[model samples]
Target chain A: MAVTRETLLAFLSKKTRADLSKIEDGAELFSSGVVDSFVMVDLMMWLEKQTGARLNPADVNLDNFDSVQRILAYAASRAR
Target chain B: MSGKPGIVVLGSPRSGTTLLRRLLDAHPNIACPPETYLLSAAARFLHADQFAAGLRIGVLDGLSFAGFEEAEVLARLRGLTFGFLRDYAERVGKPRWAEKTAFDAFHLAEIRRLCEGHVKFICIQRHGLDVAVSLRDLVDKTGGYVQELHDYVRRYPEPLEAMARAWIDTATAIAELADSSEDAISLRYEDLSADPAAQMQRVFEFLDEPWDDELVGRALAGTGQVGFGDWKTYARSSVDRSSVDRWRSLPEPVQVKLAQICNPTLERLGYARIESDDDEDDADAARRRYEFGLLLNRMKNEDS
Candidate 1:
């Protein structure tokens, strides 16, 4: 199954302990401190587990994971 | 604590800091409260010199407010940060105050410089697997002490691995910082848990407090901080030896994965690696070496 925004949301909401409903798919997670650098590494590792997407340095740039929508797009792009 | 004496407890998340804080707080003259989160909460007020509004801003440490709102708001209330804590201890009539934060290790020097009076630094270390498992348990809660590894909770291939990475990175950084700091004492969680009275006696002596058999007795007998978190260590008076050697209960594969991600750190910290089949360990080592060779080959190909 293609990983969806809801899938990313559920995983991140649990990981961040954030309120699931408030996290719009478009919210700026990285810039907003909802996810910081150390946590960002863990998120990349989790993304790989959920989507089988291996993240290199390039994939971790803000464009790919700054928000839920971007993360979903990045994961889909890298999925095997 | 420029004019008065205080204690700061530092540890990896779940490394028994709260327990230690409660024990110290149990002292008659000492008041140890829950985390203040000072560094992170007040970082927006800092200037280029790391001071908030011309006053020294070295009070908070381990906060990653790299680029936050440059609100001058944090500057206006700079005195309130340390003053509030100081006045609270005075109002409560306790001569001493203690703050516990795992990130204190990152800002030890700055904190020591910020304070004019003597500040005793104490740190605790725990095994990665046990901390990881406990962190895993906190994945579902609304509010828990898993404040340290909040991002490492998830399914296989990442959770334990990410936990291992966090443990390694943090332990290495904190250990080095603690080793280099003056007036700092370090203890292992296993040693403290196994022998509370003796370990705590050493701690009491370090803080220049006369050890009362009563304080140790109180810490062991469920006197205070009972069920504070309501999870594993919350409100429990007695240390459960059951938490020792938890890696044995983890699946063997997960154990190996933890060792792989955390091997260098575990080895550095003198924690034993998980036992594995010799053939399997050898094969995995060979595979890693092969992967490195492959990466080198790719780089060479690109260069050519």
Candidate 2:
């Protein structure tokens, strides 16, 4: 299954119990305290299960997980 | 303790001290432990608080009454604390030991005095605002039980401000330590993240220890020990520079506030000053987001 922006949003919303509407595509998640590191670890494992491959540490970082838009782009990049 | 410590790692919490400690600990000749709070606690014993002062005098007077000299009392204190460290180092098959605890940054002079010229200090620094960001994140993640940084966090109403103050005070103490101590060396966290191998080489050189390719590999893998240090470090398999400018993504008001609070120390430490708002376009956000996600995956793997 492909991970989309809405998929990531729904996950974050469920995990953080934050309003989905309040979470912006470009909003900082980990840095802004919307999502903490522990949730991030869970999300990363979920991403690996979805993508069907283990993530490379070199490829893993804040650049791919800080926002819904960025995460989708990361997913798209990994799909390629 | 069993042996005199040859190295002391000093830095503000979140300034990459844990990473450095893991690296130093991996070295064959050096055994760096997790935060022991021993040196800092010893420094506190020397504090001039009325109660502590009275206790020290009372103990010394009692010891004197028992024919124990002041020098002997001091020697006993050193033995009791440093012996454990020495034993740990020997148990780990390392010839020398190093200790790193964040609070020890505030007590460099006292630590040096107590170590009696047997210690060399390695002080690590990061841009104050970046440190402030992580510090705020830590307090949020842990729900205000950051004992490593408890002293600064409790004083301010705002987390960022409190974190900024911590960076400022710790950086200032490190700066003073570098200036006054011939045995002290300073390393920037930005530089370390930029090239950890080179930075570790520089550190090994400072300690007069041999640097090996295997040591860098071990350092990059990190110690899996769970303790009071940065939890994020446990997940890191390699150094990444994404966190170098993380403060740039902060809200403009927050950026300005932290910049104002930390600009002096930032300038002193040779980091750029954020005098006003800077643009962080969507592209920047995308880059940072991707980096964070990747770090998360690595962390997850380590967690499992």
Candidate 3:
């Protein structure tokens, strides 16, 4: 039930100090300056907290966490 | 204004980014500084805020910043990277700034987003064969290549295969950016050598700079050679077409291997394929298409 789109957006909005509605679901968060490497590490930690699963090094790339939608999908796969 | 006309110059290593950097840095109103591990370093450090703090206090070499507490520096390079660049421009009284990085092709989205609004990217490319030859020279000369390239060279049985793989990866990454980004455009090294001034005009126009044919022409003729010293040499003031086809001097089978691995990309980039024979095209075209499809599939496997 965790790692929903809203949860990710909330986490991002808190980290970036930008309005939640400002960033599109599909917008690349890192590229768009919403997250940096530090925030990315925090994001992974957040995902693991939600899914109770560790992300393999291979699973961590720009593709997985590039956007809010991709992060949700990636977290869901791990949750399953 | 427009954030000092920020630019990110990127492409395959040795594919003329350094050459472009040299030329752009010569501009009176521009400051195109050397590379830093802004992206890759960011990837490694978990506490980006701490890392940024560490960097500000000069933690990279394991030192502390004098004024700010070690814990006080912010964690976001994406937020502060352009700010630093703008600061540098202001200090130098320049109105423009750029960074030349071979790795930016992989981080294009991050760069576009970070520099948002006023950024433009100039991605330059060269023939893959030439790139392979140059990379091989670098590996031989330096006893190492970039880490990503080290894997390809060490993993492949044939060095040419590895170089081909590197070239394709670099070219494809840049291609995807060219296909997708409105703020990015590609240029050919060949054309630049053939005519530096004209090519520079195109670049300047794209960058919204007042074209100074005299400045560009003078820089190319000899004034820009700073104390690059141990860096051996860089682009000369005059166009040197000698390196353009130097890869042809590579052994025949090696040339064939490069063509097999790189010719499609080369063609797409508008360079002529290395044609050994003219009359065999019909048969070769059919076979190359099939072979290219297989190569692409193999590439997908490798990527995944």
lDDT scores in order = 0.63, 0.75, 0.66
Per-residue C-alpha lDDT of model 1 across residues A3-73, encoded as one tens digit per residue: 78777776666545576656788888867878644345446555666676556643446677778888788
Query: TM-score, chain B only, every model?
Result: 0.71, 0.81, 0.73
Model 3 chain B: ten consecutive residues of lowest lDDT = B56-65
Clashes of each: 5, 28, 6
What's model 3's lDDT at B45? 34
What are the per-residue Cα lDDT tens digits for candidate 2 across A1-80?
68987777877676555776656788887767788764675576667667766666776666777778788888777763
The candidate scoring highest on TM-score is 2
User: B254, model 3: CA deviation in Å?
Assistant: 1.3
What docking grade applies to model 2? incorrect
Segments of candidate 2 deviating more than 4 angstroms? A1-80, B1-5, B50-71, B147-150, B277-304
Winner on TM-score (2 vs 3)? 2
lDDT of 3 by residue, B1-304 (tens): 4454588786877677766776787677788765654644443332223354444323432323355433333334544666776777677788888777665554544454454455787888888888888777777887866677877878786776787788888787777777777887778888877787788888888887787767655555544445321143353555566777778766443566578778888888788987642132256443544443354344335546
lDDT of 2 by residue, B1-304 (tens): 3353468889987899988888888888888778888988877665443364455454555668899986787678777778778887888888898888866877766676677566788989998888888877877897865464676666887878888887888899888888788888899998887878899898888878888988868876765766667777867888767788888767554675677778888889888777763333256444544665566667456545
Provide the fnat value for model 3, as a fraction from 0 to 1: 0.00
